[model samples]
Target: MEIDAIATAHAKRLSVADALLPTPPNWDAAAGTELSVRDGVALATRSRVDAGSPEALWRPLTEYRLNVRLGGADPGAAFGALLTEWDQLLEESEASDWDSAAVVTRPSRDTVGTSELLRRGFAPTRVLAVRPADRLAGGPPEVPGVRIRHAEPSELNTLVRLQLELRNYDEQFGVLTRRTDEERALTSATRELLADADSALPSLWIAELYGKPLGFVQVEVPPAAGWADSYVAAGSAGYLASMHVAEEARSSGVGSALAAHAHQLFDEAGMQAVLLHHTLANPRSTPFWYAQGYRPLWTSWYRRPAVQG
Candidate 1:
């Protein structure tokens, strides 16, 4: 397929993503074989495989998408280091005779290597933050009738409902309101990551008020490779992968409570700083994140309709 032909169309479809992140519509990665966008940065590359082992299927998910990892025969490859050098990889992919494939990265302050990727011409897609230590030191103000607890498997439906409701998407990517499939994906990814101690630790936290689930945040610790780095080893950082608060619960301190809980959990685990990502398209998240002590680390995204076609 001519990537250019799909570039604009892809961007339009991805516009929905902007609701959650500051992302573009499409990007040209492998000279012009494929298109990708994460937080508005689109990348193009040739398809690497039309069909492959489970591991191969997962490569794309983990390499460039936000969905959690999958279990079963899927490959659970780690892109931690590869992401730091994405531009170089893109160059190599372009030079190689291999089939093309595109990948995207969302906004996140923990992505310190993004600036380098931008210098290599990867493109800017989103704005994100790394929260400072002591940012969430104060205990959360009590929400009457609300209780914070470790979510049980039975609560997965409630958790997923709250997750989708907060996003205003009764469905995503054609999936129905019922998220048994998505929940499986999350569980599979979490399980795979956990079974492999070297992989990043995935912690899923949810908030409930009076038997009603409100919101949640899924935080992932650095993968094993990050453990050796002085920056990470020094108890310097924790990553907030995704956070959401339901509309009904917004302005009700549910978010702050969840955030404070995340902060405390990370702090107790020895992280001195907390990092996260936000979509520039979301007017509310940026300001709220800022108030919570986050700052931009780098910007990345693909070509949107707003940019030159």
Candidate 2:
């Protein structure tokens, strides 16, 4: 069929999967490779990202990103056929030998063709979670020894260190790559995020133990997080960018306290919902976040290097 009809059909499928799912409405189908079958249709785009690019910091060193659309009653079979074409397209691309990944994101509740995804060697590596406003309705419990307070711009290095520890922790899962200049990028990224501060909105909060900082949570509310507003169907949404605690502070209630601190700010800002990403394979993260009332809204499935079988 036509690309316009494909877009409309793809959107309808996602809406049925999860009504709250923030559908990405536009991708230039004319520029992508498309395959139409008797019962369904598939469209995908192949784009590469260089390691040195700022976007690569969150993804693999280099990435052959895939934006796939499989729409029909029989998405399972259609998706299986799409993967065959996906492989052929990669083989014809120049970066087939590059150190990168072929990644696709789908609504968390979309399960029709996931068996094909796994059989084709893809794994769900990341999750974008959603916590409705009601989750923050309850007050955060008091952690006796942990003091959660707003972080200062002067404490840039301190924030970066804690954030680095998080990245290092997530590395074991293979979703986050270690960059040569990670520290520099981490510092710059952190600095830029902190600079968008609002006098009335305390976006960053640090938790201290025995007068020593141990954990932090950086949250951006509406107006503060306007960039993320489009992702949610709610009146407004907040972003939980980063939250980390030192290794020594694990299981000491510091992280819990930090989340509570963030929830309080989200409540004050009149947020309708909050969005954040977490490594799906993380042993501790999934349970901890679920306890905080966050549930998966999107899942990012990937295979390292597009050539991987």
* Top model number, TM-score: 2
Report the C-alpha lDDT of model 2 over 110-170, residue by residue, as the tens digit. 7868998898788999998888886765677777788888787888899989988888889
Task: Please report, as a residue range, the 10-residue window in candidate 1 with the lowest summed lDDT.
Answer: 67-76
What is the Cα-based lDDT of residue 205 in candidate 2? 85
The collision pairs in model 2 are 100-305
> Model 1 — TM-score against the truth?
0.52
- Cα displacement (angstroms), candidate 2, residue 125, comes to 0.7
lDDT of each: 0.48, 0.78
Give the runs in model 2 whose Cα sits over 4 Å from its true position: 1-10, 94-98, 195-199
